[model samples]
Target: MSVASEILTALRSEEHDPVRLLRSASNLLGDEIAVMSSFGAESALLLAFVAEAAPDMRVLFLETGKHFPETLAYRSELARFLGLTNVQDIKPYLAQVKDRDPTGELWAFDPDACCQLRKVEPLDAATLSFPVLVTGRKRGQASTRAALPVVEEKPDGQVRLNPLASWSADEITDEMKRRGLPPHPLVSKGYPSIGCAPCTRPVGENQDARSGRWAGLSKTECGIHTAS
Candidate 1:
């Protein structure tokens, strides 16, 4: 097996132990490992594990200028609250944005292209030197992610560590409470799944957590997770 595939197989052995999964990444990749956090609802749960596993692990936050004020504030608040010192905000290049989305309306016509411009491109650039990316995605969040594995081998060979892939929403909520972690400000307002402000909305309690992310559109993922 390739290095990525071997790592994925090894990580699959402990899908239920997020801390161990994170520690494995820390032990194996050290500084080459980084995490991608949305700082949305349920974020505090995974972040708590990251804190326990590797307090200094680099956490990448896509500062996709379109985020809600609350999300941005939550990003800062949660990172401080968790004692995570390596959180970095990745932003799109000014020239690219000026040329492709100068009017800031790319999300109105083609969210996929907009995501590529604002999120995917920036993350690709930021993570160039890193080989593994830890994520907070869980299977219960949405249908698209229902089959997400604990570790994934991307098309480009970077491994994605999803320590919470098997965790339920209730499990996350309970863990947050158990750890005394604060919820994202928007969660109380009903945004169970939060993303960029323009694309995210509040969903009914019965709906999938991610139903609010791209409401009327068929788009589910923002492109970063699935992109090569």
Candidate 2:
């Protein structure tokens, strides 16, 4: 089998263990692999894993400009900690933002539009430079992602790799501790899941892990990684 085929085969064979799956995928791709991280909750652990597993791998951190200050700081610190040499700070068009909302308040009245311009557009632009993108998504995180596959084809035919597709919340937390990694600063403050500041909130007691995102809305998946 071709090397790519082998990587896909091995990734598909597992459904619940993110660390082993990701480590295998990283070895198969090596310098060709790139991980997409927000440096949010659970992200530090994944990054640390990558650093040790494949120190030469590149990391893509999309800077939506509207991210929480903590997220931005964490991204920088993680890169320094990991000694990632080829980290890329992908970002949206600043000219477009200034043209539409000079004050950058677009996220207030029109969050979806803001996300498209700041998060989605920037990420799409960055994705074209790589053939594979690894993510930290897991099936148990929400209703929409319950059927997540370890290997899938993006609508654009770009290879979508989800190494953590089957991990449970407890398992992830345990792994983080096992690896001696720290959680995102906002995690303990009730932000079980996070995104743009305007849409994310503290999760309630009975809420699922993703409830903090777009709290009142029925929305779940961020458009950047969606197949549709």
Most lDDT-accurate candidate: 1
lDDT of 2: 0.76
TM-score of 1: 0.94
Question: Which 10 residues in a row give candidate 1 its minimum summed lDDT?
Answer: 1-10
All candidates: TM-score: 0.94, 0.88
Alpha-carbon shift of residue 15 in model 2 (angstroms): 6.7
Cα-based lDDT at residue 217, candidate 1: 91
Clashing pairs in 1: none
Runs with alpha carbons beyond 4 Å of true place in candidate 2:
1-7, 13-20, 23-31
- Model 2: clashing residue pairs? none
Q: Please, what are the lDDT tens digits per residue for candidate 2 over residues 1-228?
A: 123566667877753455566677766666656888888887876677677767667788888777899888878877887777678888888788788768888877776777788888888777765667888787888888899887776655566677767777888899888877767889889887878787789988878889888777766756787733
The TM-score leader among the candidates is 1
Query: What are the runs in model 1 whose C-alpha is more than 4 Å off?
Result: 1-10
Cα lDDT computed for each candidate against the true fold: 0.88, 0.76
